[model samples]
Target chain A: MNNAANIAVDIAIILVLIAGISRFRTPAGARFGNAMAALALLFAVAVALYRNPMLSSNATLAAFALAASSLAAWRVSAKINMTRIPSLVAFQNGAGGLAALLVAIVEMSGAGPAPGAVASAAAAVSVSLGAATFSGSMIASLKLSGKIRQTPTVVPGHNIALLFLSAACAAAAALLFAPGDPTSALVSLAFLSLAFGALFSIRIGGADMPVLISFLNAATGMAAAFCGIVIQNRLLIACGAVVASSGFILTMVMCRAMNRSLMNIIVGGKAPARPPASSPATASSPELTAAPPAPVAASQPEQPAADPLSLAADALRAAKKLIVIPGYGMAIAQAQSETVALAGMLEQAGTEVKYAVHPVAGRMPGHMHVLLAEADVDYDKLFEMDDINAEFAETDVALIVGACDVVNPAAKEKEGTPISGMPVLNAGDARSVIVCNFDDKPGYSGVPNPLYERPNAILLFGDAKATLASLIAKLK
Target chain B: MSDLLVMLVVFTASSAIGYVMISKVPQRLHTPLMSMTNAISASTIIAALLLFSSKLDSPHKVLAAAAVALAAFNVIGGFTVTGRMLKMFKKQ
Candidate 1:
């Protein structure tokens, strides 16, 4: 019966994995996948109950506690704001890591001081990595929620501190391998891991948050997998392996999108300073200077600032092909619905409307897509950076709504800029560019955008949603 | 195969399969992909359940209980959040 149950559990896990994969193929598939996942959970629970030898009073008490905590966590997650989803993800990853850490501790304590070398080593690795993931993810969540500052908080001699922490963890693990009381060493290992997680995570700046979150997610999965090894749990080993690998792939994707080194993100420091503007002008490359200069009228003041709303309305009235670009600012101002409304209005007026999205545009990956999807924006009308970049030249109006870094021309014109070498949308290629941003502030990277200085660009200074709502009203 | 060896094979095969499966996901669905994987990670609740049911001393029992609570929280919260998020992605 035990053998049959084991095989059944394994098959159920395989089915769950298949369902997870099928979710990507279609919307209906996603719904089915979610159902399969619930079924798999029920199967796992049933198998666990069947295999359990002790139905003692202690077990019942533990089960009740488990039910209460899980119910509370579910309630909190269901009520969380959509904008704060990244932080919620971070918190859940932290919870997984904490569970792994506790499991490792319990397994080690049950085995007593002189556990076998293999068990000891597994426990050591699981405890250290799990503790690290828990604390690191907590700090990431705090930063995302604005409870903590988002800038890199590097201590003096941060590298030396990290090296010392690594050495301590290694020493603790080695002590556990030796045949002796490992309790003190385990405690020290947990302490060092927690400290290292906080130190490492807080040093990362806000701009690299997506990469950091993905990396920590992978680390938590790896920790859970190691915990499974220590405890000999096949289900954890299978699920953790899947999460760890996928998270690793996602981390690599995020790094590639930013054109940043993974090691650089981990070490956590400011990007190289851009060259000063006063330096003898390097011959601007042909592609960099390709956008036609905004025509200046001789009779106008030295820097004529066009009235943004009128300019945007005029461009929209004349536009044949219109493209909207959104970024983190759009998320901040809750402008997605307004932006979609504007797009719909433009489409009604015999203009073709599309949205161009940068992969890492908002606080998390696919953030803009979710926001626009919530507003009932047509998915087919949305285009990724690579797909839409070439279409900008043929566009009559590139309506840049609360976007800065992705459309900034500095990525092309200058070297050593924070966003240099990162792929950017070609908003500058349009016949007219209308920017709906309150100010000419540098974005998360803190590199000033030159797109605002372009002559064909008109800046509308106001909150994004309000600005878009007014534009929609004017167009109507 | 030895238990450890069987686990190693399972780990390697599953990881490779996961990479291939997740890579096919569109960029627009990345967030849901993450939340769904998170739900999967909660499978460690099985380990916690077994630990709680196994024979142990008083201190170990307390620790085991804590692990069960944490793992259960992960499982319930993760699946619920993923379901809520996926429901929001309906085509209008």
Candidate 2:
């Protein structure tokens, strides 16, 4: 009967995972996926209760723990804003890591002097990876939440320090299976892993955060798998494997999007410094003061700045087909609604409008999609970079709404530049380009965008939300 | 097969399956993908609960209980958030 229950639980989990995967292809699959997940969790809890002898004896305490934790988690989920979902993910990943670390601590403390080699080794890995994930994810959360500075904090010789710490962790793990007292060695391993996690994550810049977060999520999953191996749990191993592989795939996708190797990210380089703030002529625009100062080498020679609102309005009036490109700037200015409004007006005027989204456009993966989704933008009109790149040449006007780096022409023009090989939207290929950005400050890569200076491109300098509003008014 | 070998097979096979399964997901669902995986990982709560309910002493029991709490937090928080995020993506 117990064996049957265990098998049932395993089958339920596998079904849940299958349902989750099916969500991508089927419109109704998400709802089904959540229901299956809940059922799986219930079955798992039941099996856990049945198999553990102590649960019957200490039922109250165990029930209390489960109830309290679930309530707290539910409250957190209820309160978190959609915009801060990434930070919430980071926190949950950290909590998972902490759970694994606690399991390792429990096992280590209970192990006799002559614990088996397998158990010791598993425990060691569990502790090390768990501690690393826990601390690293906490730092990632802080960076995402604006609690810590968002830029990469590269300490001199960070790689060497990480290498040294890794060596220490390995040595401590080896000591766990050796003859002497393993307790002190385990403690040292945990400390080193925690320190390594902090040091490793602090050096990663904002541009690489998606990769780092995915990588850490994978690491935490593997650590949980190791904890399963130590405790001889089949369910954990299965779930952990799924999470690890999924996270690994996401990490690779993010890396490919950035056109950077995982090795390059691990080696820890600094993002180029942002240029000094550029003061815009329009003092009424509050976002100008908030925009990063333009570097001294302002690429665009101030062509008696044209009235961008009128220029954009005229272009829209004449345009037959328009493509909208949005990036981190749109998210920063909270302009998705305004962007959608502008698109609506353009559509009403008989101009065909479409949105082109770069893979790594915003602060996180799929950020622009979510923001636009919130504004009720039709999903059919949204196009990925590859799908939309070919249409740029025929596009009458490519309206870049606060997007800079992704539309920069320098990626194709120059060699030895930061974003040389990165796949960017072909916004520059359009007959006319209008950049609705606060200033000419370079993007996270800190490379000057030559697209702004192109003859076909006109800069609409102001806050994206306000500028789009004005553009809409002018169009009317 | 030894217990370890059986586990190794499960781990390897699940990982391969997971890679294929996750790869099919569209880029737009990446955030929900992450949170759902997190929810699955909370299966470790079973191990924690079993440990806590064992005949261990006070300190070990406390640690095991803490593990249960943390894992429970991941499970509940992860699923709830994933559901909320997915609701936003429903056809409107």
Q: What interface RMSD does each of the candidate structures achieve?
A: 1.8, 1.8
lDDT of 1 by residue, A44-80 (tens): 6666667665558567867786888888888988897
Chain B only, TM-score of each candidate: 0.90, 0.93
lDDT tens digits by residue: candidate 2, A1-476: 22666666676776666665666544247656766766676676676567665646555666778789999999999888776777888889998998898887777767434657787888998899999999999999999887999888888888899999999999988888777667788889989999999998898867778888889889988988898888777777877888899889989998898788998877746544554442342343445333222321143346334355666677788999999998877877888889989988889889999999987776566667767776777767888888889999999999998787788777888887778888889998898888888666777777888787666776787789898988888888
Please give, for residues B26-46, the per-residue lDDT of candidate 1 as tens digits.
Answer: 888777677767666766677
lDDT of each: 0.78, 0.79
Number of colliding residue pairs in each model: 1, 6
Error of 1 at A18 (Å): 3.3
Per-residue lDDT of model 2, residues B22-82, tens digit only: 8887777777778878777777787788775656767676777788889999999999987
Candidate number with greatest TM-score: 1
Off by over 4 Å in 1: A1-5, A111-114, A273-306
Deviation (Å) of A300 in candidate 1: 12
